[model samples]
Target: MRHVVAAVAGLIFALGLGISGMTDPGKVIGFLDVGGAWEPALAFVMGGAVVVYALAYRLIVRRPRPVVEVKFSLPTAKKVTTSLVVGSALFGIGWGLGGYCPGPALTSVVSGSWEVGLFVVTMLAGMGLHQVWERLSARGSAAAAPAPAAPLAEGPLKGVDA
Candidate 1:
């Protein structure tokens, strides 16, 4: 049932992408080329997405928990770290060069374009490399660190163990 729902949703999303000209690398590249032969349609798509997400988030947050989940799985990290900066830079560079991110790249694959195939291949390779790097970093940190001591205070009341 979940798979059926997911497939239907994916099909709808892909249709939207195709209809919106997001599956065309030329259109995306034109959007990125701000100074020369720029296409502003992508901005409208982004703005629509932002508005939808803003309203959806507000609605979702009003609920104590999501209908499909026990709790919201929010990221704990808040700081802008080196990894975040490097990742953002890499993403921006890839988008500028290929004119296709993962979502659009996947959709473009259906168009049977060789450029889309190449972009998807490179994107998969990047994802694999990221997974490998993350595993190695996690192992290194685990091997180098010792467990921290527990907090002196406990429970609802201060300095209480109950």
Candidate 2:
């Protein structure tokens, strides 16, 4: 039931992207291109989305639990670190370069565009690389962690240094 709802929601979102011209790279790039033939349609779309989300969140978040989920898992982290800043910058740069953010790019995949395929592949690769980096970081931190003191010997060897 949850899967069905999620699938339906995703389909609706994709349809919205397509209908709003978000799935078009040219339109997105044009929107980004300030001081040129800059488009304002996406800006209006985003503003409308934000307003809707704000209203929906204000109402929905008051509920004790979600309809499908046990509870809402909101982000706990509040501190902004260097990694966060760098990752955001990278994401923005990638979006500007490719003229397609993750949502739109994923939605555009069904269009059979080779550029979209390449973008998806590289995006997946970047995600995989981040996973590898995270694993290595975890291992390194584990290795660097100090070990606990060993317990004393029992019985006859309790007093013995060796």
Candidate 3:
């Protein structure tokens, strides 16, 4: 049942992207251009999404738990870290350069454009690289951490019966 709901939600989102012309690299690039023949239509789509999410977030938080989950799995991080900054920058750069962020790229795949296919493939490869990097970083941090000191030895006869 949860899976069905998720599929339906994804279908609706993809349809929205397609209907809003977000699946087109040219359209997305036009929006990003900003200086030359900027396309402002997507702004409305984005603004509508923000408004909908704001309302949904408020309503959803009032519920003790989600309909399909035991509890909400929202982000708990409050501090900005280097990894977050770098990841966000990379995502923005990729979106600006390819004019296709992950969602739109996946939706555009059905169009059978080689460029989109290439972008998806590259995106997947980048995800894999990120995983590897994170694992290696975790290992390095663990290795650098100091091991717990050995428990101090009790005085002689400490274990012997009095």
User: In candidate 3, residue 2 scores what lDDT?
Assistant: 87
Give the 10-residue window scoring lowest on summed lDDT in candidate 2: 150-159
Give lDDT tens digits, candidate 3, residues 20-114. 88998889999998989998888998999999999999998999999988987775545666756887899888898989988899998988999
For all predicted structures, in order, the TM-scores are: 0.80, 0.84, 0.86
Better of 2 and 3 by TM-score: 3
Instruction: Show where candidate 3 strays beyond 4 Å.
Output: 147-162
User: Which pairs of residues collide in model 1?
Assistant: none
Q: Per model, state how many residue pairs clash.
A: 0, 0, 0
After aligning candidate 2 to the native by TM-score, how far in Å is the CA of 48 from where it should be?
1.2
Error of 2 at 123 (Å): 0.8
> What would you estimate as the lDDT of candidate 1?
0.74
Count steric clashes of candidate 1: 0
Q: For residues 44-81, what per-residue lDDT tens digits would candidate 1 score against the true structure?
A: 88787789889998988889986666786654455666
lDDT-better candidate, 2 vs 3: 3
lDDT of 2: 0.79
Name the weakest run of 10 consecutive residues (lDDT summed) in model 1: 153-162
Q: Which sequence of candidate numbers ranks them by TM-score, best first? A: 3, 2, 1
Residue lDDT tens for model 2, 1-162 = 889998999999888888888988889889988889888789977887899989999999999999989998675445665767888899888887989988889998888889999999999999899767766765666577644221211222321221
